[model samples]
Target chain A: MAEPLFDRIALIGIGLIGSSLARVIRRERLARRIAIATRSPETLERARALGLGDAYSLDAAEAVQDADLVIVSVPVGASGSVAEQIAGTLKPGAILTDAGSTKGSVIRAMAPFVPEGVHFIPGHPIAGTEHSGPDAGFAELFEQRWCILTPLPDTDPQALARLTNFWERCGSKVDIMDAEHHDMVLAIVSHLPHIIAYNIVGTADDLETVTKSEVIKYSASGFRDFTRLAASDPTMWRDVCLHNREAILEMLARFSEDLSALRRAIRWGDGEALFALFARTRDIRRSIIEAGQEVDAPDFGRHVVAHHPQTPQPEEG
Target chain B: MAEPLFDRIALIGIGLIGSSLARVIRRERLARRIAIATRSPETLERARALGLGDAYSLDAAEAVQDADLVIVSVPVGASGSVAEQIAGTLKPGAILTDAGSTKGSVIRAMAPFVPEGVHFIPGHPIAGTEHSGPDAGFAELFEQRWCILTPLPDTDPQALARLTNFWERCGSKVDIMDAEHHDMVLAIVSHLPHIIAYNIVGTADDLETVTKSEVIKYSASGFRDFTRLAASDPTMWRDVCLHNREAILEMLARFSEDLSALRRAIRWGDGEALFALFARTRDIRRSIIEAGQEVDAPDFGRHVVAHHPQTPQPEEG
Candidate 1:
């Protein structure tokens, strides 16, 4: 299409996000050669089997050698260890980035070990499904999604532009923000939702009065929605919580306070208060749809034809 | 098709559930003539525009006249008034039912209006999307979903059988449950989830620091799932909260207690407790998939094919 963005790209930790980037990079010819590595040999093997990279290695240091770009896609808690593993071998002019959910912790974890010439930018893709691992990713995962970059004060402008261009090529819109602000924003939008989901599902599971079978059978109402989030990778989310403690705790405090007020309203049978709150939240969903974050089911049916070359188009509406 | 189940079917309150039943009943030829009635004339006109029924009216009394079956699908708060309006016009042997979310209050509100010899059976189709209104319905909305019937103590067996057969024709599995039990079960499954969703969205909206644009932009993580449930009809959900007071309050108490325990675990950084709870909930999702309750996203692409008759089938793996 155009000259490849990077001569060689090294992906350290080939999980859902890494594999997805690998697929997108390969599809768009964004990198000439790709090196995949994870701490676990089995995962490295799985990446090889998936044909995700030109080279696969269990040594993160070996993987980043001579790479023009290195993306660390491990859990937030493991960012420091991954950085430690690859620190000495990182190429002089390489762009070092990460796909950790928490920006502040990732920056704190990796910034210490980043080579002087490397652009160690902290980034988080504001998109993911509940599913995890290599098989759960697809090339379209990043399409029309946001990717936030938290560049350090001394970060080179040219390195930032190159990395932003790479993400753009992978079908993501990029936004730059301070790591602390990104952490605070994501705590409310992403981290807190996952925490609340896990909490609610756990609550339902532990209920002695409401049998498990009943919960599972009648879940189509709303509980099922929480289940999808709760079913997310326990290790990844647990690491997110552990790593982003301050932001998450702050969001949780706010959420609990607000929930208490709601509980009080419900307890007092305040219909007007409940109605007002419920009415206001409807706009958020409208905003999400307007922002092109989700597909309306009927419209999705129509759009599917555009994706599938074999399928004939539906009659005009 | 099978000697029309009812001579005439009157649907009072044309919203998502009501309009869906109308569509399915028409598709399956379960009723000879359909009479649609809603309190708002605009909704009645919209139902007519959608060809949702053979006749449309604003008068509940007029709609129920000579109808062999009457299905009231209004918010729980409106159940009493709808029952009062249609009580005088129900045919002598009409099987009267409702599709309200709350069961105990609906039965309490509707039971007083039952004319002698009219079989009053309160029912609910445990299926819906976040969308409302007549346009949000489809014939297959009820397919493979559970339709719970909470018949009164002195309800006629013959009427129950006929209604069960009617729902079966519309492609739903039917269950008969006591009104109180149904309320409690639904309090955990439906009401709590909606209330939680509404609360979380409200919490996010009220955040002094996080901007609305930030919430919308980064919503794909987990918050977007809650938005779908939060976007549900405010009036309907408000009525559900007010009407199903006792069961909902009880469930809320349990949910809050469990949530507090989770908060404690998180505060203490108990990874084992968090991981254990998160891991356990994964089984429920598996059960739901196994029970054919939800279509996984990948499978949804294939399942949508059932609607397109012109498309050739993809080979099964």
Candidate 2:
């Protein structure tokens, strides 16, 4: 109904996060013209097939030409290359940002190439599904989710406000913080969880004592929850681990130290210590639910209740 | 309308599994009379208030005096104590069973106390939620779930058949397994997942660089998945860890070994190994869904699509 927020906006990747951004931008009329680009021709064509953008390109430089905003949504490992390719092409006054999970490394990778006039802000949107690819995204991916923005010291206030406003319009609550702190926060919250999930699933897959078929059949007991995270896009997660090496390894060290203590408690039959740890963790889940970071449902409310005549199934995504 | 499967069934615990059994047994008329007992007076009172059983008691012997079946659904660590309490009072031809998560120790604990004519079967129902206690359960909890029964040698086939039928009527698919094998399978599928979840959540909570509030706020990114499993009943899980020590320790050793390799790959920026591991785990999730062990929803489909105008949210629980 009204004029779009930006005359031209370019999305440098069109996977789950990128395509979700595209869908929301298009749904809310946040951008009048959208250009999509990816390293892979097939993905670019798929993005075009999904009707995700006004224009599509295999070349990042070409995609960013004259764009009012350039959002790089590629794997964190590729940020430097994407920045290098688009450095000479990004419009003088355009806001250049990213949707990387790790802020410090992404900034380190992209900031070196940014020209003087372009605004460079690294943002991590704390939202996504395990699903990847253009077909996997919908317009509601960012709704009621947090988006953290890490701006450079000399960042233009007008540019930061505009980008903050853009994310808010896309239904995300914006939090501004230091890039290093953002990386540390995400290492614990995102990277370590993914690594632990992948590791445990890999462990189960390799166990001779437990048959793979058995693991698959009885997953509902608990293992399936980890599988959702382990099933995340390989390239995306791999890049995250590689890019956020220092913080991730630190978190991993802490995780292993704690796991060793748990192992000892179990081995020694120390039920008191184990129970205290388990009971304390329940408070965190309650806090997360109270903060609206999680839904208040048992077992994530996945199991449908068909056995009861009076009870209806709970609402789901 | 129809004769109940058992004349009187006594449940020796009033937690999630026990309460769910009580609800389903009533709904399906599997038991004409249900007697619920718990060690804790408060839990027994709560079970009575919820109408989970026809009769309630704080004494295990009093509950099982005239019952045709006695189902011990307490924490695994208390299996021996429960067996000792009910050994003298059980009816001669009654079936004595348990719904513990661990099988080998439960079998060891309860097998010695069974009366000559009574049948003793150890079962691990691969169904539950993160929630615990009487109010957290429902009739549909076991629907379409796997209920594994581990029976001793020289067991009565008639008794096993009747118990199998009881669970079948509760909407569970039954699997008969060796006690040791059941323990091994569950260590990989259930026990290890919960332990890993608890350990990771503990690790996040103890971090010096990241605030606990930040972990709670950004949990949706990945940490929330583990929080669900970590929030499980502390006494039950603590008992499980202690009772199933050998199998769990074996699984934990394997998990830590695999995690080391994964950490090495990340530290060395071995993208190929990381991508391969991540991609392979996706197939396991698909297999679990195909096997009817998991719901095929991304992010457990927790995020409802209130922000989308055209896209409808998928049917949910």
Candidate 3:
């Protein structure tokens, strides 16, 4: 492709996002050398087995030694610890960025540990699947996705450009925004959806009148859509909820108020009110589809039929 | 295929569900002659242009005249009017059923109008796309999905068996349940998800801090998934909420209560509580996939690349 952008790139925490970065780096030849490290020995071995990097280690500090760029891809809750582990090893002038869902919290967690000469930028790639771990990653995960960078004040402009270029090469369009604004936006778009999905699934599970088996059997009705988000990695989502608490709570409060009003409309047989809201929501989906954020295909273009091992084997009694 | 299930079949209300039934009926030879009717003159013309029926009419009564099987596929709220329109024209020994989301309400609305000797059964095939109107119809929409029939005690066994056979031939597995049970199950699995999706999208739209473009750009994170369900036909969903108000309200209360607890957990920074709930929900998705109710692939198996007419053409400023 092009000449390597960085002499060495170290990835801390080899999970879905980390491994996906590794794949894209290798595919695009974005770095002359790639070093990967994870605290979990099993994950480290798995990443090694997957050949996700040129060098692998259990120590985040060891992995970042002499690396020109260090990217952290870990649960939002673990950002501070990862920053502490690798802070001393970053080469001078090296760029350290993170792929976490919450920007404000992540920036607060890691900024203090960044060495004086190092450039620390907080970034979140608005892309992922419900699946996790090294094997779940692919080079194409970031294609056409938005990667939002929330650079701190005094951050080097050259380092920001280089990181943006790196992400652009991996098939992402980068947007620079204030870290606080990023958290608030993500609170509505990301955190709240996951929390709502998880809550609804839990509610369905706990229903006494509607059996769990019936929920599973008839899920194609609408419930299955929520399940995809609910099925996302628990650790990552938990961290998101904990880290982005204030913005998420504000969004959730607004959501509850709106839902309550909706509930009232249904209670009062206000078909017009329900219709108006439903009609209004329809335009948003159209806009999202038009904006290339969503597929226009109905049902995300799922095949008409697919057989899976978990498919119901017998009729419900 | 085998002998036609009905000598004449009338489908009243030629929207997405109705039109889809028309296609599948033609493809599978489910009816010797298919008669389609819609209240909307525009839709009637579109269905005729698409050749979706052997006979087309704007009058529901005229369409059902002499038909051995009458299927009312309008919105749940329209079931009563359609029943009133076609009740007097139903042939002797005809089987009348409907594909509506709320079985209890549909049955309650239509039961009084169904003429004696016309076996009245309520049916809901748990299949569809967010798209609506006659042009969105496809022959395979019902393939491998569930079709639940909530037949009254006085419902004819032979007529129920015939309807079951009809759905089976269209590639759905049939489940017979009480109308109330069907209403409650669907209230949780179908009605609530759409309501929640609509509410969340509305919330996002009303946000003062997050620009609409920012929400649209970053939707891939989690928000886009909900938009699909929220994009579903407003008239249909409105009818669902109006007709299934009690069951839906009950589910909504439960959902709100559960969501409140989740909000508290997040507010308290209880990562363990959030993690436990998050982890529990993943199993349901796995079970749903196992039950053949959902796709196991990530992002609902969306194409890696898809072109939309509304896709953004320029990078953000």
Candidate 4:
């Protein structure tokens, strides 16, 4: 068997990303020892109970001791504090990274704390379910997903290569780009979508003319798709909203402008404009499917998802 | 064996809803014969090739001859024309209904053309996959879904009851509401969601900062869900936007207002407000899942959807 890529991997904040990393690192034999740390004692104990790592500590500094790779997986808002806590402990010449959703903000938050010998390569893995916490994770969460590494200009090539190789071994296709571009790309693809979903769900919830019961009962009509994104972890999304503010605001403004045009077309009975917009969006879904970034099944394959098999009970006439 | 509810059923428009109704009506023995009609020769032939009906007709008027039930399943903008085409031939005692998404507009357009003795009931079945056309349907599409009937003030009770039974037998739980209220409910639950989805996908596509391929490659991060609704039949959505203009506009305005508040929260770093909004929306998803309107699987069960098992193959060292 090939030797593990890292002798020790210190995981700060064992939430969904951290726990999943722990599981995958163990499954792929990417690390010989996993050190899990989280602020909440309850969460740390839960990770211990799940047998997620070889060692567990409530203090992140203790977890990073002698670790070859240190991954900080906290909300983007907390990145600086987490970085501050463990900067003195991260092993010299060790690779430092993160699984944050925002790149530029996280880079800004953590860069100043990095010690001389540490190689900090910020990454954002484009993967997750609408779930959080240690138990909500599995080894397969990163499979066929993209893990984007935003390496600073001065980062060591050997460290970046080793980190990319590790992510590949753990089932992610690795992409490299600068933090600013990564932030902008994610703001459109992720941050804007989530904010729009959250906002729409709030709108639906607040309507006086439309009862909540009716909305809930008929959500499968179209509204349920947004609910999946809306049900995402509140703290994490709030952090993304704050940390990626400018890009998100820019995307939202563009979306609102486009929506105004759509509203105008509807008001004027401009069927051509409506059809043009609706017709063009289909190609993107097809491309996403072909790119292996989405499920090819129609309606996200909701009909075929096994647990919801609602075949009518045989009725005795 | 029980006798079929309708001796003959006429289906106008052989798209997703119409063809699914044909399959389910046959499977549940609700109709002894289904006479399918559509405007396009290609769609009519496709319905015929799919064996979707016992009889096929290019003319809806010809198809409705002596039928006990006539279901017009077309884009909302085309409802009145269909009603006019079939009105002269509709059997006096037959229950005439539609499967349009908007109730009020469909009622206004269709009611004036409905002949005196034929029972005219406007209904919007809260069931469908994003796929459209005859081939995209199945016998079980209506199972465990809601079928909302919007009966006009003068609609006969016996006709309403009979039509309700038909939808029920076809495996939908039926609800009755007035056209105005139904329109408002659907405007929030269905129309606004589709419009917002279309708008967001359009926004993501029109981005200068993010390339189209980048959006497609990272769509699973969030944007892909909107594409499902946006991928829906363009003609159908175009008509829906045109027909449900007022209620849809109201919902869109409300949504935009709420979005403004959310954007403020993001801009000012009001984490509590952002978290509060995000936290409250989860209950709705849970309720929808409990109401059986949504599958409880995380990520719409993308992980469990059969075709998407991109498990990493074992690698030789």
Quote each prediction's TM-score. 0.94, 0.96, 0.96, 0.96
Candidate 2 lDDT over B1-317, as tens digits, reads: 86799999999998889999999999999988999999998998899888889888999999999999899998898999999999999999999999999999988888888889999988878999988888888788898898999988888999999999999999999999899999999999999999999989999888888999999889899999999999898989998998889999999998888988988998898989999999899899899888877766576666662233233322232
Better by DockQ, candidate 3 or 1? 3
Question: Candidate 1 chain A, which ten residues in sequence have the lowest lDDT sum?
Answer: A298-307
**Second chain alone, TM-score for each candidate:** 0.93, 0.95, 0.95, 0.95
lDDT at B113, model 3? 95
Q: Candidate 1: deviation at residue B142, Å?
A: 0.5
Candidate 4: which docking quality band?
A: medium
Question: Model 4, B10-122: lDDT tens per residue?
Answer: 99998988998888887778888999999999999999998989999899999999899999999888999998898889998899999999888888898888888999988
Computed on C-alpha atoms, the DockQ of candidate 4 is: 0.54
Quote the RMSD, in angstroms, for model 3. 4.8
List where candidate 1 sits over 4 angstroms from the true fold: A298-317, B298-317
Sorting all predicted structures by DockQ, with the top scorer first, yields 2, 4, 3, 1
* Candidate 1 lDDT by residue in tens digits, A1-317: 69999999999988888998999999999999999988887787788888999999989999999999999999888999889889999989899999999988888888888878888888988877777788866776787789999998998999999999999998899999999999899898988888888888877777777788888888877787787788888899888887777888888887778878887888899999989988999999889877877544542332223224465433210
Q: Write the per-residue lDDT of candidate 4 for residues A1-317, one digit (tens) a residue.
A: 88999999999989889998999999889999999999998998999999999999988999999999999999999999999999888889999999999999998999999999999999988988899999888787787889999999999999999999999998889999999899899999889889888989999888888889999999989999899999999999999999999988888889889988988898898999999999999898889878877766556545434224553221110
Q: What's the ranking of the predictions by lDDT, best on top?
A: 2, 3, 4, 1
Candidate 3, residue B62: lDDT: 98
Q: By DockQ thresholds, what CAPRI class is model 3?
A: medium
TM-score of 2: 0.96
lDDT for model 3, on a 0 to 1 scale? Answer: 0.88
